[model samples]
Target: MKSLTAGAEIDAWCTKCRMDLMHRIVAMVQSAPKRVICLTCNSEHNYRAPRTETTASGVHVRARNTGPKPSPAAARVTQKARAEKERADSWSSKTLGQAVDAFTRYAMDKSFREGELVLHSKFGEGYVDKVLEGAKISIMFRDGARTLAHRAN
Candidate 1:
């Protein structure tokens, strides 16, 4: 087996190309390649060993796993739920003792300043977090912070 070192060319699974391609070692840890750049596509990613399986004929063949994996949509839903809970907690703490009538109704043509409270038809009550460039404003709602257009003048 050839020795491994930084800048050495080796066969690795390229995530971007989704194939075992020639890669140049960019980083090494404990004499093992930790990161590599694909020579085919010029994409940099963590090093993954090329998977091989022995057939009944005693020959090694490259194998790719085609099994069912965890759903990304389910993972996204879980993360969104956690983030929504956090945002709700923050909104509650900020809106404590504040009256509902104190919030100004949201209007695209109306101007708003940072630290002011506003009521939106779609997003409910929100606090103006920032006055952004080009008549845009970031508002923190119970769900999350959102950018909306407003009158800058």
Candidate 2:
């Protein structure tokens, strides 16, 4: 058996090149390459092996999703993204002209509560998700979540 170590040359499916390319091992765990940098394009990503699943007929079936399921935080982020998209779609139906007046104006020196929709002068419309200490609040806008200051005094 050959020893696989960092800096070792290996073959990996390059995400950038979209083909099997020679790579330099960037990280190794228990003699297995976990991360590699493609020598062809210098792109770094997890090393992926040819994925196959055996069926009852003993045929190697190509796997669809080879990686593990998304983590909880990632799932939450995805959910938040979906919710934001739904909100955006509903926003358009709510009439942007009048909707802008519906959203409470956001003020830096004012107070806000969670679930309160505020219209940011620059960030467009967003809803407060959390209120933190020091007058900082996490608000979800069209772009994404952001922490801003409020109630300076």
Instruction: Give the best candidate by TM-score.
Output: 1
> Which ten residues in a row are the worst by lDDT in model 1?
53-62
Off by over 4 Å in 2: 1-98
Q: Please provide, for model 2 over 33-145, each residue's C-alpha lDDT reduced to its tens digit, 9 standing for 90 to 100.
A: 99999999999999875322123224433355355777899999999899988877755444355555568888888888887788898998778878989989988777667
Error of 2 at 127 (Å): 0.9
lDDT of 2 at 43: 90
Please report the TM-score between candidate 1 and the true structure. Answer: 0.43
lDDT of 1 by residue, 23-114 (tens): 99999998899999999999999998864411332342223434367789989999989988987887777665689888989999999999
